[model samples]
Target: MKAVNEQEIRASFANCSKGEAKRLALPRDLAEQPWDDLDFLGWRDPGAPDRGYLVTERGGEVVGVALRLSARQRGHLHRGMCSLCLTTHPGSGVSLMTARRAGQAGRDSNSVGVYVCTDLACPLYVRGKKLPDLGGRLEETLTVEEQIDRTRAKLSAFLDKVLA
Candidate 1:
């Protein structure tokens, strides 16, 4: 992924109003992010832990979506898998992240939700850059490149649902 500035990130949002995008916080550590290792930029708002955001290059354009953690949904105690990277996590490592639909539907309060890594670190997990102590992620036959592609596809599909 390419390094992006605050203005670019704010303008890339597809599921929120201009005002909301403007108010949304950009990661304070942009200068230190591992850009080459990222498929997308994702982070939970420091000021608002329930609020999350994701931005990526899709179909030749930069696109972004706003996400909210469904705090009412509890994580499984034994094992859980992130729908995006397919990484297994124990306990509270996975959570239901919801995204408001784009355009008028979003304004009407319609949204979509999926189980994802609590910290939105699917890229790192898939690459084995970061490992949790849970030891639940099963060994896979798929190669690293295949896993990356799969992760990107899953995220794109989710974005498609939001845009729809």
Candidate 2:
């Protein structure tokens, strides 16, 4: 990730209002982030936890969206998956991460949720770059703790960008 100017970051958020952009706590140094492994950047505003956000550089521009927590106990199997990484969390793999919308659009933007991973693996880490296929069962190749750490790493990077 390279450093991004405020103007550039703001422009990426064309769908948002100027006031919303001004209020967001975006990262100042992109170089400090681990861009190689991140699926997307995610963070919660320190001043307003209810005003979390995510930013992904699509094409050549940064696209950010304010987010909110939507914790719901979804039944296993058919629940939605994370918007970034496509992993399933089974009985515990679901959180409805709704996005903050424009003045009037928010009232109807229910579909723009964060769709958190059931394990909530942070997007910055999580071994999104896979190693060679292991020669054994999935459980034998990677321990649960290892799996969580990878996810957390990704999440931390995104959080840093947003909270910075």
Candidate 3:
């Protein structure tokens, strides 16, 4: 992934109005983010725990999506896996996040949901920069590059669904 500025990030949003995107919270540590290691920029809003966001490149152009975390609760003993990276977490580490479909469908209240790491750090987890609290780390025969490719593919598919 490439390093992006605030204006680029704000303009990339597809599911929300421009004004809303402008008002959405961006990471305070954006300047310090490890852009080279990132597949996408994702974060949960500090002011609104249920709200999350993701920004990534799609076919050379940036695309952004706003996500809402499901209200359902999970037990700490129950293990959940991120659909994108396959990292397993004991509880709140994984969440059902839904993004409003882009355009008119979004106005109609349509949304697409997927189970993802609650922290929205799938790339970090896949690359071993971050570890899931419960599973330690996933063991796989695929190389780091292969894992990164796979994770990005999953994300693309999810974005495709949202855009559809």
Candidate 4:
């Protein structure tokens, strides 16, 4: 994925109002991020842990979405899996991240949710650049490239739901 600037990131949001996107916090270290290794840029708000953001390229256009963590607290005893990267994490390593639907559906208070890594680092986990909190990532028959593609597909599907 190509590195994007703050203006592109803010303007790419499809599911939130422009004012909201303008006000939301962006990652401070955009220049330091591993852009070459990312399929999408995702981060939780430091000032508001429950708020998160994702930005990526879709059909040659940069697109973004705002996410909110579910109200339910996760237990730290059992293992959980990220729906996007298929990485197995122990306890609170995964979360139910949700996004409001775009346009009228969002106005109607509709949203979609997916189980993802709590820190939203799917690309790193898929590439072995990052590891789960408790156990190591699950071994898979697919190559790293294949896993990355799979993760992108899953995320695209989720985005499709939101954009629809």
Candidate 5:
């Protein structure tokens, strides 16, 4: 991942209007983000918890998507896995995130949803940079690079579904 400016981030959005992307909230700590360690930049809007954003580089261009988090938390006691990183969490640590499909399908109210870490910090979690207290991290048979590759592939697949 590379460091990106606000304008670049705003212009990267693919699933929403340019105006909406312009108005969407960006992380306040963007300057301090560990860009080299990120597969994507993701954050929940500080003023609007239900609103989330994700941006990743694809084919040398940045692509972003706006996501919505479900209002109610489900199965807090159950073990849940994030589709992106394969990290297990107490259900409360995971949330259903839905992104409106790109173009006309979005206008038709079509969306793609997946269970992801509620904080949307899978990259950090997978690298052992940030640890959640509730659910223990999964022991991995693969190397860190392999795990990162897996995460990226899964997330790219999800993004493809949204754009399809």
Candidate 6:
């Protein structure tokens, strides 16, 4: 990630309220982040372990969210098919991760599912990591960009539901 200022950070949140956006936690060492390897930025909060955040660039604009990591499942290894990236594994280490509802004040959803790389890197996906022959598993002819777009839109919709 770049050394983003408050304004630059705020601009990433397109649909969230100002109050909620103001409370988002930023990376401590933004300048040192491996931006070139990330498809987007995502993290688990050290202070509130269940809390998390995600920021992605779609259509040349930044879209960010304050998320939460809900209940954990033990020994559940990641197959490396990113729910967010729609990219399958390439023998690289990756994992399936989940997040809690950000603005969820009520209503029964304890968690949301996400497939994150074991390395917590999005740049690899963004730059298009080489995948081990998915072989008709993805079920479509769309390009990588289209897959990313669909995943992002799904995430945005999920956030809206949480806030609403």
Error of 3 at 82 (Å): 0.2
lDDT of 1 by residue, 39-123 (tens): 9999999999899999999988889999999876554666778999988788777888999999999989999998999888888
Give lDDT for model 6: 0.55
lDDT of candidate 4 over 61-108, digit per residue (tens)? 999999999878767788888999988888878889999999999999
TM-scores of the models, in the order given? 0.94, 0.53, 0.97, 0.97, 0.96, 0.53
Ranking by lDDT: 3, 4, 5, 1, 6, 2
How high a TM-score does candidate 4 get?
A: 0.97
Q: After superposing candidate 2, which stretches have Cα over 4 Å from the reference?
A: 1-3, 27-31, 71-83, 86-94, 100-111, 117-122, 128-164
Q: Compute the lDDT for candidate 1.
A: 0.88
- Would you list the C-alpha lDDT of every candidate in the order shown? 0.88, 0.53, 0.93, 0.93, 0.92, 0.55
TM-score of 3: 0.97
Query: What does candidate 6's lDDT look like per residue over 46-155, in tens digits?
Result: 76755666776555566676554435433333345655555555443335454444454432445555654444444445445633343112666877667656755766
| lDDT per residue as tens, model 2, 90-126 | 5444466655454455545433545665333344324
Best by lDDT: 3
Poorest stretch of ten by lDDT in candidate 4: 131-140
Model 4, global lDDT: 0.93
**TM-score of candidate 2 against the unseen true structure:** 0.53
CA RMSD per model (angstroms): 1.5, 9.3, 0.8, 0.8, 1.1, 5.9
Identify the runs in model 5 with alpha carbons over 4 angstroms from their true place.
Answer: none
By how many angstroms RMSD does model 2 differ from the true structure? 9.3
